[model samples]
Target: MTTTLITGANKGLGRETARRLIAAGHTVYVGSRDPEKGRRTAEELGARHVLVDVTDEDSVAAAAATIAAAHDGVLDVLVNNAGIEGRTADNGIVAPADETVDTLRPLFETNVFGTLRVTHAFLPLLNRSAAPVIVNVASGLASMALITDPEAPAGFYPGIAYPASKTAVNMLTVQYAKAFPNIRVNSVEPGFTKTDLNGNSGVQTVEEGAEIIVRMALLGPDGPTGGFFDAQGPVPW
Candidate 1:
């Protein structure tokens, strides 16, 4: 069976993606920072639980070890979905002038650095698979082509930290796909989904948000890598 792991799978887009992948016959590992929440969600979804706090080194290592042991050091797919949006406002920046290093550090810690840490930790297991795939959950706001347009809606958002970090994720995705041609890796924008990340103001639902993530996570060896896509199709980087 295809074995897949999704970070931050306890709730929202991650959880929904786990559900869909499980339905697709994948042996899904639901990863979350809290063991209690992770186990509960895994049980509910008939999946396994891996305690993975992407922001922490030890936790990510332990989660990797656990999955490696259970799956014989082979992971077919990995979904990097754990992320944090900076303190948000209704539609625009939250204290645009006050967005500083201190306010934005935590966002990068989880969204960018955390993704690098988790992906690095799981590379061994992923490499063992006959066909490996990595899905980096990104945002529409991260696209320079869209966000730079004065008439574009994504640019109107007042947040900088979240979008900037996701943009970093986009570049990282491209680089990883280039470095590991054997593995299918891509970045996916979930659009504005109704999740805690957006304070539930997103027009779409979690199920809707997880569409591209699941699609990218399950890509075959022939599928495109080093690209960014959304539910509608290719999203400009």
Candidate 2:
């Protein structure tokens, strides 16, 4: 059976993606930091639960061991969906001028470094699969082409850390795809989906946001790799 793991699968887009993949006959592992929430979500979606805190190395390693033990050391797909927006409670974006190392650190910790940590820990298991796949959940704001275009709405966004971290994720996606020629590694833009990450202010639904993620996670051997895509099609880098 195809086995998959999705980080931050307790709610929002992650949870939705887990549900869809499970329905598609994948043995999905719902990765979450909270054991109770993770177990509950997994039960509701008929998936398994793996406790993981992407920002913590020990936690990520333990989670990897758990999945490997459960699935005979083989993981077909991995969805790095854990992330944070670092927006203030009032939903204020830190201006570029006000951006400091301290201000930017939190976002990078989870969105960038955390992604690397989880992917690194799971590489061995993923490598053992006949058709390994890795999906990095990215953002439209991470697109240099879109954010730099004067006519694009993303160009008007003022946040510095979240966009910068996701841009780093896109880079990671490219490098990983190049490094692992056999694995289909790619980044995806979920569009502006209504989720806690955006304070429910996004324009689309979680179902819509998870479309590209599910599509990429299900890629076959001939599918495209090292690309940034959304539900509509390819997103500019």
Candidate 3:
């Protein structure tokens, strides 16, 4: 059975992804910054727990070490799901660019850079698997094409910080795919779903949000890599 580790797995989309993977019979590891929360969530989901703060180098290293030992250096999937929505600036596009930059910086610390940290640390373990897959939990708001479309009412038209961070994640995903052709690396937009990040304003459910992620995680070796997709299909970058 493939072993999958999902960062920020304590709640929201991360928690749902872990639950789904466990139900599929894969050994799932729930990675959270808080041990209590991670352990409890894992216990509830019938999976393992790993304390991982993607923003902290030491924490990320320790998490890799723990997982490597348990899985005997073989990790099939690494889900870069830890991210922040960043604070909102009420003023739409005319909002202070600094506000967006400041808010986005912290999110990137976990979303973009954190992804690199975990991927680099766990690559050896992933390489040991027959089919290694890396799924970056990006969003449709990350798409510059969609965000810049004046004709369409896209989700990207709103938050500057969150969308920009996710865009960076998409680019990072592309780079990872290039760097490791053996590993399938792709970014997926989970669409707007009811979750804590949006205060549950989304029209879709968490199960719907997790569908694309779980699908990407389970892709075969011949599956497309370095692509951006949603539940329905490919999303323009």
**Residues 164-203, candidate 2, lDDT per residue (tens digit)?**
9999999999999999989999999999999999899999
Off by over 4 Å in 1: 88-92
Per-model TM-score on C-alpha atoms? 0.97, 0.99, 0.93
Evaluate all candidate structures by whole-model CA lDDT and list the values in order. Answer: 0.92, 0.96, 0.88
Clashing pairs in 3: none
Prediction 3 global C-alpha lDDT: 0.88
Clashes of each: 2, 0, 0
Candidate 1, residue 61: the lDDT equals 95
Residue-wise lDDT of candidate 3 within 121-191, one digit each (tens)?
99999999999999999988888888789775574365566777788889889988998999999999998
- lDDT, candidate 2, residue 143? 97
Candidate 3 — which residues are off by over 4 angstroms? 88-94, 97-101
Which candidate model has the greater lDDT, 1 or 2? 2
Model 2 clash pairs are: none
- Per-model root-mean-square deviation over C-alphas: 1.4, 0.7, 2.2
TM-score quality measure for candidate 1 = 0.97
Highest lDDT scorer: 2
